[model samples]
Target chain A: MRKLYLAGAGNVSKNLLSLISNLNSDIKIMGIENSRGQLFSEESLSMADINNFMKSPEDYRKSLNISKMDFDIYVDMRTASKNGERERDDYINLMKNGKHIVTANKSGLANFFPEIGKASSEFDKKLYFEATVAGGLPVFSLIRSSFPSFTVDSFTGVVNLTSNFVMKKVNDGMNLEEAKRKAMEEGVAETDMTDDLDGTDSARKAVIIANSLFHKPMRLKDLKYSGIDENNIKKNEMLLAKISMNKEFSVESRVFTLNSEDPFLRLAPMGMACSIGFKERNPVYISEDMDGPLETAGAVLSDILSV
Target chain B: MRKLYLAGAGNVSKNLLSLISNLNSDIKIMGIENSRGQLFSEESLSMADINNFMKSPEDYRKSLNISKMDFDIYVDMRTASKNGERERDDYINLMKNGKHIVTANKSGLANFFPEIGKASSEFDKKLYFEATVAGGLPVFSLIRSSFPSFTVDSFTGVVNLTSNFVMKKVNDGMNLEEAKRKAMEEGVAETDMTDDLDGTDSARKAVIIANSLFHKPMRLKDLKYSGIDENNIKKNEMLLAKISMNKEFSVESRVFTLNSEDPFLRLAPMGMACSIGFKERNPVYISEDMDGPLETAGAVLSDILSV
Candidate 1:
């Protein structure tokens, strides 16, 4: 039986915890952590206790005695934030402790690609992050598992769900402020909404894609990106943001408007879409018509099963 | 290191052999068989020998001294036909001999699922056929790898490329015969093209998808289907055919004309597309803009690596 540790008590983490119990009876959740605290158990946490723990803020992370504890896998489902930096450190430590890491946190990968790579290799720990970019759509794994022999010509996608929602609303005649407000109300956008609007989120996703698909290690700062918030367009200009990379494997992401007749210009408001082109075959298009939360959780669970 | 066997000399199989040499040096082709003949080697087949073996067909299959031979995996990339039953028997025998099987042949699974499933489990062999339905699209593996916990609500797709090609051509102001001829010229449709035009091909694909995605064991005879050839409609009524299934997990597929504004009706002539809905998340769309040659080979290589 595999023992698992979950980092973060956010909606995605909670959803993942709920799923792991029902899917595989042999695997047990050994611990859970959030910004406020953590709880560890030799026995699995009951559903009621899992929910209660999500709401509770008591720190019991150290109770298990980290140096002496043993678990097979550590899943990080935390969102990108300053808290994520600390989680990233913990992830490194967990890898050193011989815990296989599965993550939905882009910040963990986008910020520390080389360090994480070295640590995973040093400890012989397998690290996977399918949820980092377009988690709802299975683009990364498709390339990794299905089309490894094909030479990738290009990859382009609308990776940011919040910005996509805001843009769709703007196209429907809502002002930018109202659109952002609506995205927040729908629980798709964060309260600040800066990451979604400023292109950093998409840039981070682009970096992950470039690294995973093209073996091009890129930082979020290396991307040439421009956000949607900085632009003011007329009614005719309906802008959408996408992260794009060519055969050269350089990540270039920007917000732009396309003519209506372009086949690739179809957009979904609260979803993610991507097209991966190969040298030997036609492009593969993956489009997800869902918000981020459930898909993120699903992607995390997928990585868990993979590990 | 893995010992591999190629079970066909068709375009897709030949392409796969070409790719395996470049992609992974650890995997070696131990044998190859076609209707014309077979080739066997204890050592890896040289590139020259592989090409020569594909071109030369002098029956040496039984000469391998079956009782003395050993191989780890068998990949069946043969197209579905009368000869396929013999190949299916070979698959069963290979599994009985402890060879894990990967296939692109729908007939093997669609027709004899129970027998194949029993043989695989009884012998503890894995039978994977990711290249069976819409081999150009990574739908089955995507669902298997990406969404493990989500309950599938529905699966719908334009599974047959020939029918899609014909429909696109008819919409472009060509008669059915002309459209079919065009598809044949493009090598997307068979020379006879009866299976594609009569919906039998799509029905076989539906059976595969039903079994793989919905866990519904269905056969070609179980589906309600009508081919494009049986339909007669006005030129103004542009028509497209798609295979569709709902939460009932029953296969209800037919060819029909649709209203112009239906977004789902839009399709590429040489591509495959499918949308999968789940209980928790919104629908995920997988679109493939190519036929089964390179993509099918890619899918086979994927299953090969998986084993």
Candidate 2:
């Protein structure tokens, strides 16, 4: 049996636990943690228990008798921005301890790819993060498994859900504040929307894709990215956004004007799409519908099974 | 070094050899065969030599000095329908002789999957056929690597290029004969187009996908499929075609009328697309551009690398 340690007790983690608890018997949840600290469970955590723990992890941190860090797989689903560095450190420690990792956390991979990647290779542990971009779409996994058979000259797509949602709403004649508010109400955008609007989220995904798909190490800070400034959208006008990598492996990510027939333009609100061009064939297009929290959980589950 | 044997010297085989000769160094071609007989090469077969041999295999078969059947992988790219059972026997013989198999041939799998699959597992050898569906689109490969991660509730797509081409041409106001003639002239349809228009090709692909993806022991004869009969179409009529798997793993493939906005209706001319719906999330749509012999070779190469 493979022991799995979860690093986040949020909705994504809960959903994954719920999925695995019912379907998969080979993998068991050994431990769980949040901002406060950690809690251990030899038996698989029940959905109600996971919910209770998510509601208040600190309450159980002091009561659980077992506190083991030894696990076969470390699943990182934490999304708190402030805990980014700590989460990275936790991942590094886990890898150093010979633990395989599956993550939906983009910050760790996009920001500390070299260190995490180095540790993973040095320890010879499997590291999977298909959920980092295009939640549950299998974009990254598809490239990793298929690119060996063909020559990919470049790739382009809409990897950001929040910006796409907001931009789509704006295109439908909604005001900036109204669109953002609607997105937030629909759980499409986080309360702190700077990351999405400022293009940080998309840039992080681009960096991860570059590193994983093209084997190019790109930093989010060094990437040239422009986000949708809702102020720029005129009333009832259309807006288009896309992220692309050129033949030189140079990355370009921004919102721009494009014809409706463009493959990138077909992306729906909160949907992610990618077009990979090969040397002698027409481009391969893959896209997923609106990515919700449950979808992110689905991606996380996909990684867990893959690892 | 891994030795790879070619069982056919068709255009697809030639393209794979070209790709492997240029990109991959781990796999080296040791022998090749055509309809006449087999030829051996001490070194990798050059593109010019391959072309010349393809033009007149009997001449090369008579002149080649070295001949050997011992190889690590047997690449079957032969498309002769009359050689179907013979090819199946060859595959079983090769597997029994401890050789892995990679094939672009559909008749063998669509007809003799049980025996081949049993032989492969019994001998502990790999048998890969990623090129069997959607040309070089990696459809089967993607499903193999990723579907195990999630619950694939159902799948639907256009898996036949010839039928898609014929239908698109028919929709473009061409008569049945004109459409078929144009498809054949473009090499999109086989000269004997019965397999494609009669839905045998698509049904074969469906059997392969069902057997491979869902682990269902399905046969071609058990499947109900309908192909495009140009006589059934009226001028300026919109025709929508798709291959879909239901929740019970039963497959439904036919041409019907769909809304203009349906993703199933958005297929390009000679392009193949599939939408796979999971248990909880939206469907994942993957499509490839117009497939030619070169693309089929790309798929075969993908299998070679994977094996």
True contacts kept of 1: 0.83
Write down the lDDT of every candidate, Cα atoms only: 0.72, 0.73
DockQ score of each predicted structure, in the order shown: 0.73, 0.48
Task: Looking at model 2 chain B, report the run of 10 residues with the lowest lDDT sum.
Answer: B235-244
Which candidate achieves the best TM-score against the true structure? 1
Stretches of candidate 1 off by over 4 Å are A42-52, A59-68, A83-87, A229-231, A234-247, A263-265, B59-68, B230-247
| Global fold similarity of model 2 (TM-score) | 0.85
Give the chain B TM-score achieved by candidate 2. Answer: 0.88
Which candidate gets the maximum DockQ versus the true structure?
1
Residues B1-307, candidate 2, lDDT per residue (tens digit)?
7788887877888778777767745887777887786667667656676667777788864434222355788888887464257667877888888889999888888877777888889999899988887787777667656545466667676787777778778777788889989988987877888878777787788777777666677667777887766578643223222334453446655565665666655667778777777666677888876777777787777777777
Scanning candidate 1 chain A in windows of ten residues, the lowest lDDT window is A234-243
Model 2, C-alpha of B214: deviation from truth (Å): 3.9
Docking class of 1: medium
